[model samples]
Target: MAYTAEAPAIAAGDDPMVPRIGRVRRRVRELSDVWTLTVEMEDGRPLAFAPGQFNMLTAFGVGEAAISISGDRDRADSGLIHTIRAVGPVSGALTRLGPGDVIGVRGPFGVGWPVDAAKGSDVVIVAGGLGLAPLRPLIYAVLASRKDYGRFALLFGARTPADILFRREIEQWRRRLDVEIQVTVDTSGEDWYGNVGVVTALVPQASFDPQNTIAYVCGPEVMMRFGAAALRDAGVPDTAMYLSMERNMKCGVGLCGHCQLGTAFVCRDGPVFRNDVLRPLMAVKEL
Candidate 1:
């Protein structure tokens, strides 16, 4: 039977409709285009969230963007971390803010990765570009409870060596003997010394037992399709793999149909979905 995990509901004290005031605790320029912001709730409570869920960040006058929560879930006292690419007005504004600035936030909403279901299985994580941001928390969770799983592999692909999101952390993760890290870039300069190709190429080299592996993939739609195809060819069933999807989400609740993909709302039903549930919708380009 296919494994279709139900999306968990928002916890008590987390009202997606009510925007909370949060202060920017810190900001780090991750890349020329990407920035990581740490925010603390005005009330000093932690912004609790599961891995793969996102928050809608309001830039006061500019508007809002749905950004995935990228920090460690177990350390809520450290504040919520959002890694954002400044590609628009709102994101640009949010990125420009410094510490002590205030912003409107709603969420920690939507579905999350199936970490519990993946216990005892080999884990394969494939990420491309900024997609790594959303998947970072999952990696943290897996590493924190490393003994519960079998082999682990993380294959990341970026536009260039400079485009990699978490370079220092990737290096630290690489030092762990139990975790496998493979990095590749689409283009490279002389300083680069890594694989060069699409992320799917690294998929073939991952050391996971195909039948007993659970794969998590995030990236461009095209990249995800190819990654899913690669995982399928390697013997992973559709039900054992998942992907993250993004859409125009006006409201975090189900009332806004802006993020509807077929019957599923990217903001409500998922941002994370089992491959079997998303494959059909992905085929229709207009969705």
Candidate 2:
């Protein structure tokens, strides 16, 4: 008998169900409310991910959470940087871990923002609250290769002045002549002076080819739903509009069933989906 290499499976198989465990290199606090964690394969391999993909972040004994990749893939030292909000036990625990802490990583999972589909097309990104976390990579991707995209617009909203993430970066983006940055907050203080409304309010102010524009939206479910409607009203096609979804997930792989939505799994099928594809699902709850 001769030894032979196993042929790679063509069909989806058990391997897709297995999780890839990566080690944490460092955890840098990005803001008072969020932390950026960088993790890589113990074997020191680059994590190949497209803009908008998320990974399952696991802390030993605590549990797993789905986090979006926030680093530029073109950067060599870039690993996975999940900008996490401390909202629960798992996330709270994650905030405490520092350099040399170990965490489990299962994927460069989920469908990503359609950078390729939007090539040469006008891009509009609308994000609210921590929703900006997933959209960061797409922003970086477009700016890094600015010539590849056309008229760019970013409309972001937060609950309050304090809730805004990526403040410094947003300031830098505001200075660029090629891109537009519009920010709004749900509420405002005396010192705060900017657009004060839901993110939907900013859509009407944008000037772009609805027929040629692709919109990426992420936020609270209610906000996303409303944002999609606003885009349609602005004449952006449903097919060209996309949204990043978030749900409770156990296995970053599809085996756990925690993140299942209808026939799709948010972990595997998508964190990013066309607005038209999700419209039907948005009507149903926990399907």
Candidate 3:
């Protein structure tokens, strides 16, 4: 249950239930079932959003699904970009859309990564599989102001070489001398030559002061749990760790308790939470 982007239900003047019209400017196939859509609003206003924020995209007759905004944070004026996997009716419909097609757009809802709090401190990002899409904005933010922080590291894991997302873009990022990028796979085929293991295995290889570092993590629940544990073992404090939690969120707002985790609503209160608030909830069984 990863809600990559969980922003507010509605902005001023926009109804929460009513979705605005948007036209797909471009669509790129990232994987066999995943597509990245670059959309622009019908009225020409860009969808202003923060890092790790999410939006509910509607597929007209099909339905709507909450997807993370996966565009460069520095280019907010380019409307919206969402990376979606065709796993369901709504999402499949989204992936089928092509250039000039119309789609429905909703809130860029919820609180985002505390990137500002991380300024002046070392920053590390841990992501797995599709989890990287939501965290990409944060990476852009970090790279946009690389001088503000120290020792930037990105540790990512995918199921296989073909399963890796944003491969070319990630390789471009790897070219930066200031960033320490480590990518791993669950299984490396004969065509591939890279580390083969879980992403946490690369955490220790990152060069950052545990006491002075801030960590942002997103992935499958099991992966996030282990990643947090690995970071904790490396001496990073609980307060310095943040995670994006996912749930079956129907409404982008807090009205629906479908996304309730304990007493907090993932759509309103957070899709992102500090480890201090998340640790206890994650440790309990059936929570």
Candidate 4:
């Protein structure tokens, strides 16, 4: 189920094709089919990664999947975390793992969010459903250095209230006076009483200096496409907006062309890319 690409696909003096053994430290259920697993490498080294970067995780006998390191960047020195939804064969296997189980781990791969570039500027982050997983670390990094940036806003949406990931953590964040966090669901139950719309609907209402703003967005391809347009209509330029396009990433490295998007490789050039660089490629139908 794997193929070779190039011998130098992996740098940092490690083999690109080999995976290190990782033991699950803990597992928490986030939703009906979603779980967050905390893991530590058998070698005891941390899977320290930049915000928005991802890893290739193996469920041993099943398969491997590319997942973002969904942990607080400030605490990643302790271990790695990945919040995965049981949507596919590999992911289903990943979710079935529990504490004390061993799995295969590779990477901390690809470019990360431009946290440094946002210094002294307003930051608007938008996520839909599980997209929040990859952005969690960026939120932690930004707040840990709150004074380094200007206005901050987060807008999230899910299919239903029950499908909202990190519900409690997000509620805690909404309490912070300095950061603006809003959550909306597509459908509401009898007990639901919050906004019932897409996350992009909150973009135009967000408070930020469009001329000095940097935005990060992640979600379904359709969601991200509309989300980018919403940010642009709200006055943010394409250059200042970034998107995470994590699709068809077979190899964490570029050796496998499975993640190719136009001339760029989602596993190499991105998973994160500026709107200006991605819009054209994304516009091509069925690309």
Candidate 5:
């Protein structure tokens, strides 16, 4: 028999890693029904992050919440922006915070969108309701590296027109020739004139090369599932579509069981996963 040699297994420690640790320097930058927080680096450094990645936020006495980074990916000096909706105890406390207030921040955690994978391909981004927060980072990433990809489209749907975040940013994207942006409401207010339908309905109007396009979706569970289905129906391959998952995250690291969704951990394995990898888990109600 001819001698054959096997390659040595690569060591995980040798891989280039994003620093897993972070610090607490709470400074509230903007607030509304949704609080836009900026956590300054204790050492006065900038945090590098991809779109769709999130952080574990801690209030003094209240518990922690997993929030996505909503700031500009290109602006490293800007720190991190967390657009938090006041839905619980910790979040309510966060809403009351303002400039110079102290809060603890850990991680720019979770798996982010596949920006590197989408490079050189057409991109279709779908976001519903609060999903915009996670999707915002990706939008900024794409725009900053605009020449790396082909045509881009963003389709967002909200419960009411008033619930939409990033209104000013959306207007700016719409004005750009490289991107196409659309907004829809499930139930329109009297002032809405553009479109009134589910976010999936708007997907059909966007141009994409099924073979060369990559799709991303973030929203409520139902919306993620349905929006992914819509993309599949529109000829996008199952492997090319990705969805962001939501779960209760306690420890930002994998030690906590709060974010386990079956065999996958939303906090560790993914906050963003390919459609085929997520299909089975997203269909289960208890997970």
Candidate 6:
């Protein structure tokens, strides 16, 4: 299949650093602390995004936060979805917004997942906690083009059963015979019947040819490092493993240097990077 990159839509006279007004179409509370907001440009233009790009959302008086675009890439009319956890002031303001509320949006920035390159290869997706939000679009792209890939396995972990994001969608994916889904939690409750352990423990259970598999991992920095090691043990080479790196991003562009890791800028060079390129830098504590 031919892959064509989608050019980001910009309104006339719009500045890349300036935020455009967007209206909240709907808001769904996914978990106790997490909320998903569906927002559309006030002008009604479709917000096009690749599988792993993000947007800097601003609440009028509040500050801004870099949030991954979590909606289906193919459905432009459904608006952009951002699953946010109210952990701080800016995020708290975003979560407090309801349908019809207006907010500022300034992106579709950062390099996205290499879903196209993974075609014909077995794919392993590993996500922990809120990291799953960024990987959600990649999963949609993969499943939407299911025939183009080999086996698909998803291993996800969260704090507990209640902390799991997209519970309904996860259940639906689990019901699909073509997809393999395993979930784990750091701690389990009496209501939880699934595995009780770190997400890496479920990595060995995924059935994929290590040589033919491409892995995408996103989570806490420590969790990502461990997940990459586990994938390595499973036979996946560093070249075949990718990770999403999170950092303090003051500017969506590389000019600010806030999101820099060594010589690379997370906002411009990547939010997604192959393990081989990032492994060395990740080992450095100061960076």
lDDT of each: 0.89, 0.80, 0.88, 0.87, 0.77, 0.89
Give, for candidate 5, the lowest lDDT window spanning 10 residues. Answer: 1-10
Model 3 agreement with the true structure over 53-151: per-residue lDDT tens digits? 898899999998889999986796876889998998999999999999999998888778877788999999999999999999999998999999989
- List per-candidate RMSD values in Å: 2.0, 5.8, 2.7, 4.3, 6.3, 2.7
By TM-score, rank the candidates, best first. 1, 6, 3, 4, 2, 5
Q: Report model 1's TM-score to 2 decimal places.
A: 0.95
| lDDT of predicted model 2 | 0.80
In the range 183-275, model 1's lDDT, one tens digit per residue, is 999999999878999999999899999999999999998999899999999889998999999898889777978998876778877889898
Candidate 2 or 3, higher TM-score?
3
The sequence of per-residue lDDT tens digits that candidate 4 reaches over residues 149-259 is: 999999999999999999999889988999998889999999999999888999988899999999999999899999999998988999999899977878877898888
Could you tell me the lDDT of residue 52 within candidate 6? Answer: 82
Residue 22 accuracy (lDDT) in model 3: 96
Candidate 5 has a TM-score of: 0.87
Q: What does candidate 2's lDDT look like per residue over 102-187, in tens digits?
A: 78776667778877777899999989898998899889889988998889999999988888888999999999999999999999
- Candidate 2 clashes: the total is 0
Q: lDDT score, residue 130, model 3?
A: 95
lDDT of 6: 0.89
lDDT of 6 at 33: 86
Off by over 4 Å in 1: 1-15, 284-287
- Provide the clash count, candidate 6: 0
lDDT of 6 by residue, 111-136 (tens): 88888888999999999999999999
- Best TM-score among the predictions, by candidate number: 1
**Candidate that beats the other on lDDT, 1 or 4, i.e. the better one:** 1
